[model samples]
Target: MFIEHPSQALNSLFRDKPYQGVNPEEAKFLFIGLDANYEAQIDAKPIFAKLREYHKDGAAFWRSHQVHHPFLLPQYSGDGRFYHRSFARIGFTPEHANQVSFIELLHLPTVGRSSLVPADLNEEHLSKLSQIVLAGTAQHIFVPQAVARLMHATGRFAWLLKRPSEQFGPLGILYRQQAKTVYSHLHFSVYGKFEARKINEATAIRSLISAGI
Candidate 1:
């Protein structure tokens, strides 16, 4: 189900917050998602309340979340949970994970793929997202395909849809000029196989980052 908005408590608490992660301005990589995710049994209110308390410190936020969040658990480079596996495939080491930042286009934690669509974003939300992205200093930006498409359609992030791009498997590389940072358009789950060929898109993305492309 699509949530028009999170609970009043959550909205009021984090209305002004735009991103998550440690030292976003200094981080080398950014992993952007649609929103926070939680299972049916999880109560978002208290979870987010704690999240807000640790908002000022990304490291603490992540460390605390590791206690109950399965996604934060360690995984090897392949054949594990999709979330951490994709992280590994993208060249994100455990230490490197702390070095990167993760931002969500929307607030509220939900189970499964989010039902929140692009049209749900109002002008205020769009402005905040644009400002956050344009101001961030991360050299490598990884944006999910759905979020990228949403931004493109809204014209808030059309710069990512420009040329000087390359398509590798399911990933589309959109080179940004600001500080030579690159925006990678990737699968929503960040894991997929190219139907036309046998290529691991996440690994390809990591290779691109390694090649300094």
Candidate 2:
């Protein structure tokens, strides 16, 4: 399951008065996404440190892993080869790397310095790259596509199609179309007023378990 903030959220889940129906032990995997440049923020250090600790523990406990967009990682050329290597270092087996059960980080380039929206990239190119990422990291690839198509057919894509700056929600919907079925129990905490608070990891995990991920 995707745990937006497994560290803090987990604590909250374990501490909140009455126990809920969720069982944490049932979680076999945890996928985490972190902002690479989070350390730059003076106030974000403590939270980031906690997240790193949680990441290490989760990786050991559930063989969990992480995926970061190019913008989040250190300086590196935006090349497919670089991505392949990065994925390997994150513990993706060669075979798994070519399948749909793995996690992926999608990156988009902005057109100008003042722009918050991403550049209008070629859809075909994005699709091709997305296909590669899915094939290498997914176990149930068809489900995500089906979800996206269903959403698209029903006009849900209309809302998702808006640029990040234009809409406060759906910033990560593109990746939703490529997740494996097992990872469908995923949710992203984008930069917005509503999600202003950093995600608490434990809480996210409990929520996922409750949701039957």
Candidate 3:
């Protein structure tokens, strides 16, 4: 696959600006989402600019960002509970959430509740995301089921999807690769109510732990 420079690719992911999480360079895991949800009209340029400024401080960026935007913190009373639980299941330490990066397939915020409107990204966007996925430092990548479906349907990401996947519990799928691992689970909002999958989730969690991810 033809690869573009990191900054150039990331620019596409965030609609012509490179936006990434705190300590992306050192992160061991990546939690990806479809897009941001907000009820107000937003201009993301300044937000990305602010993030770039805070991200320069590896020691303080995570906490500082959390202070300013408590909703982004995993411990907050939000969809992040899904991430917190999954991180624990993987035997990952929560105090080190800075070691995990958050990536969005689309950076634009949707009004009210988030939905799978686009379903998939265009070629230009997919090429950019592919560059990051192929070369980034995060060894473990997690995405919602909707995003996973998008990847599976897009030809640009076919190289990764072609690999056989292991069924992870009742509503998740896991793919192991030489350099990284990809796991797709139910959307965070629905995850809490999906009680029927609990037993299988435990077994899958143990399998994931054994995989050394």
Candidate 4:
């Protein structure tokens, strides 16, 4: 089996916030996913691959490359073939990809051929994940409906999404808040009435945030 980011894996197990340098307030949108695409990430993008090699020396490399810090993230080199297009559904453009905030539920990239989210994800990984995500103060937070379900199954952070108030703001939106976060869910990466659905979701999110509900 091919070892992917052997060094990065070691670092994540120790680092509570593997993505340390990014500030939640700076992010326009906080995107949460189960993990990363290791094959496409390490094999195709030299800059991202640096996460593996650089973290071994401490967080220098990862911090340097963070998109929101001082630089903009160009579309990943292999974006057309590798990166998912669903982001466009949520108002993220190639330009916004740089300011794009990301939090992986599991920081460890799966080894060769292993699925991203296993049936039994490690509890330690899940625990820190809750902290990293909850600590963020982003105005908008999004995760796939699938991710909501999985988190619910574990009974951990599901409470974050349970309350939706009838008190909608100007644009006909409703929301529920948790600590520093204002979050909602959608069918991420599951294609359907692509343009229309995203417009609706984006509108609601904007309204909710603006209303401060």
Candidate 5:
């Protein structure tokens, strides 16, 4: 959890925009599942850095912008590891309570006795996650289903494959497209491909609100 000041160019790219009447407190919590390997990469640093910068900015941008609701990083340390250690606890003070909390799903280290086990969705941790969301402490959960699936297929989480395509815009574009064919089964509002392509941070925030996340 290294925090870096945003450069002028980065600041200009994320300048605050006019609010369309959306309130931050009322905004839905967006839980973002970051790929561990992807996050470790040098290029991906900017994305996380930008997210941190946006939250620290604390202006109108804070009002309209949705924080990465509960940042869940997978744990990858310790011998005979059975659980994922949270990065929030590893890099930053775990006591800094806020509207959002990030959880890191720890993975097994490469040199460990065994490879990282698949995250147990049925575990008490997940039950607690649901409780946290139900308590209004959390808003919405965003898991990169594609990345999760890939991780399931392969024992390792590949960073390059998990990186979002900036050639488009906010990573939500990829989610929106997939939401149509596969995600539609979840019964959430299915914004069409045309609408999905237009998603940005603001639009994603609105969608989370509209979806009742």
Candidate 6:
């Protein structure tokens, strides 16, 4: 498996740019989803599927990949190169995924639209994922629309959503006290077959920064 989760300290999983406009060293928010689908494949494996020992959380192997492509912002007409330049005009760097902590609700791989996970996804799996998700100091968090609701329904991670969050129709804001993290839900997708709201920089950044992260 050709993975970039090198033991190289600077290029460690935590420092790897796994999303657009994310720089873990500088950003204070995290945007998580089901998994990644875009990037130069290794032996035809989705970047997230190539698990390496260096990955602190194999379930989140997507973070181990250097993601420079705009896999989430399809509304940009797949023209992030020029669209992101406008973001630079506003003083926010674009196409960097280091700052935004990257993780996935399911540390599994989506093959041709089929998401495959461990046959037996038990508490242990969730526990490991929870640890990785909480370990980050990022104050702002964004999860796919169904992720937060499912986490809330699971009766797990109540500690992360101890406070009543504000629900805005299809969106909501979950709060945790330990790090004062705010979790926002969004519908993100780049697949033409799947209809989902495209992720936007303005909304995501504003929510993250306004959360006081």
Clashing residue pairs in candidate 3 are: none
TM-score of 6: 0.50
Residue-pair clashes per prediction, in order, are 0, 24, 0, 0, 18, 9
Candidate 2 global lDDT:
0.29
TM-score ranking of the models: 1, 3, 4, 6, 5, 2
Candidate 6 colliding pairs:
21-96, 22-96, 22-97, 22-98, 22-99, 23-98, 23-99, 24-98, 24-99
> What would the per-residue lDDT of candidate 3 be over residues 68-135, giving only the tens digit for each residue?
23334443454334544544444433355466566566544344454443443446656766666667
Question: In model 4, which regions exceed 4 Å deviation?
Answer: 1-17, 20-28, 44-100, 111-119, 132-136, 162-175, 178-182, 203-213
lDDT per residue for candidate 5 within 124-181, as digits (tens), equals 4333433433343333434444434533444332322343343222432222232221
Instruction: Name the best candidate (by lDDT).
Output: 1
Please give the distance, in angstroms, between residue 181's alpha carbon in candidate 3 and its true position after superposition.
Answer: 0.7
Considering lDDT, where higher is better, how would the candidates rank from best to worst?
A: 1, 3, 4, 6, 5, 2
All candidates: TM-score? 0.66, 0.25, 0.59, 0.55, 0.28, 0.50
lDDT of 6: 0.43
User: After superposing candidate 3, which stretches have Cα over 4 Å from the reference?
Assistant: 1-20, 23-26, 41-61, 64-69, 72-95, 113-122, 162-164, 168-174, 191-193, 196-212
What TM-score would you give candidate 4 relative to the actual structure?
Answer: 0.55
State the lDDT of candidate 4 residue by residue for 1-213, as single tens digits.
223455454446336444423433355566666654444434435445444443342224334553222112464444222133444434433344324466665555554554444445667767756655656456556666555556766677754554443422312112344444444455444445555665566666655445554
How large an RMSD does model 6 have?
Answer: 8.9
TM-score pick, better of 2 and 4: 4
lDDT of each: 0.55, 0.29, 0.51, 0.48, 0.30, 0.43
Worst 10 residues of 2 by lDDT: 17-26
